[model samples]
Target: MKEGWTWRLPCALASALLLAACSGGGARDNPDDSVLHQDIASGRAGAEVTFDGTLRADPQPVGTHEHLTVTTPAGDVLEVDHNTSLAPWVPAHAGDHVIVHGELYIDPGPRAGVHCTHAHTSSGCPRPGWVELGGNYYE
Candidate 1:
């Protein structure tokens, strides 16, 4: 009985360790981890550029504020906020590919986008400073 218990203890511990490693140890619990808050804190607002990266969406707060953290290809992070219609793309899951086009707002807060919207569409969303998207068609 003693020998069996001793072997089982180590096996149980080893199984627990393997499970923790495979589970990612709750790393995805905090969705804001991908957003580079340090850069926004250092006064790098109003700097607009095309950023492409994996999309991580926070599940909390429902759809009023669609929070998306983009991990840029160059390793920089940017958070995109869509205050408009959040029904289309809220509660996004991690690992979703996303591309954002908007100016960085500096005043009244950290570097973040205001009035930003998603660029995902069957026909492709419109680029900034060119045309507005999702409206009555005019030719």
Candidate 2:
């Protein structure tokens, strides 16, 4: 009886640890936003990039897109246009940190941002994209 109890205890503890790790409870690695800066400096557009930032505001639905602003660690503010027509809207709020993977676009004018944040890859969106908030990925 004693040997059985000892083995069960270790097994239970190991299972608990594995469950926490799989549940995304541990610290997540910070995303590199510097690539985005490089893209902007090189006048690059329509490039797929991954970065992290803080939400500047709640998501607003416009046409078929869910638009939101994000402030990067380097203080660069960018507009994130997630297409709701292709995927679900991200449930993010102001001040929430999020990881974004999308295609970057810089207009001829002053505005520059990212779009094509969806899971499906099509002609319009060659590379799949997603937004990570609180361990959940919304594409």
- Maximum-TM-score candidate: 2
- The alpha-carbon deviation from the true structure for residue 16 of candidate 1, after best TM-score superposition, in angstroms, is 67
**Global lDDT scores for all candidate models:** 0.47, 0.86
Q: What does candidate 1 score on TM?
A: 0.41
Q: How do the residues 34-113 of candidate 2 rate in per-residue lDDT, one tens digit apiece?
A: 88888877878997788899999898889999888999997778899999988888998999999988899997775779
- Cα lDDT of candidate 1 equals 0.47
> Candidate 1 — which pairs collide?
none
Query: Can you tell me which runs of candidate 2 are displaced by over 4 Å?
Result: 1-30
Deviation (Å) of 84 in candidate 1: 3.1
What are the candidates' C-alpha RMSDs?
Answer: 15.5, 6.3
Clashing residue pair totals per candidate (backbone < 3 A): 0, 0
Query: Which residues of candidate 1, in runs, are more than 4 Å off?
Result: 1-44, 57-63, 106-115, 118-139
Candidate 1 lDDT, tens digit per residue, 1-139? Answer: 6757978998999999999999898432212323434435666555444444676555234366455666665565556665434224444557766545444555553335423354332232233311112321111
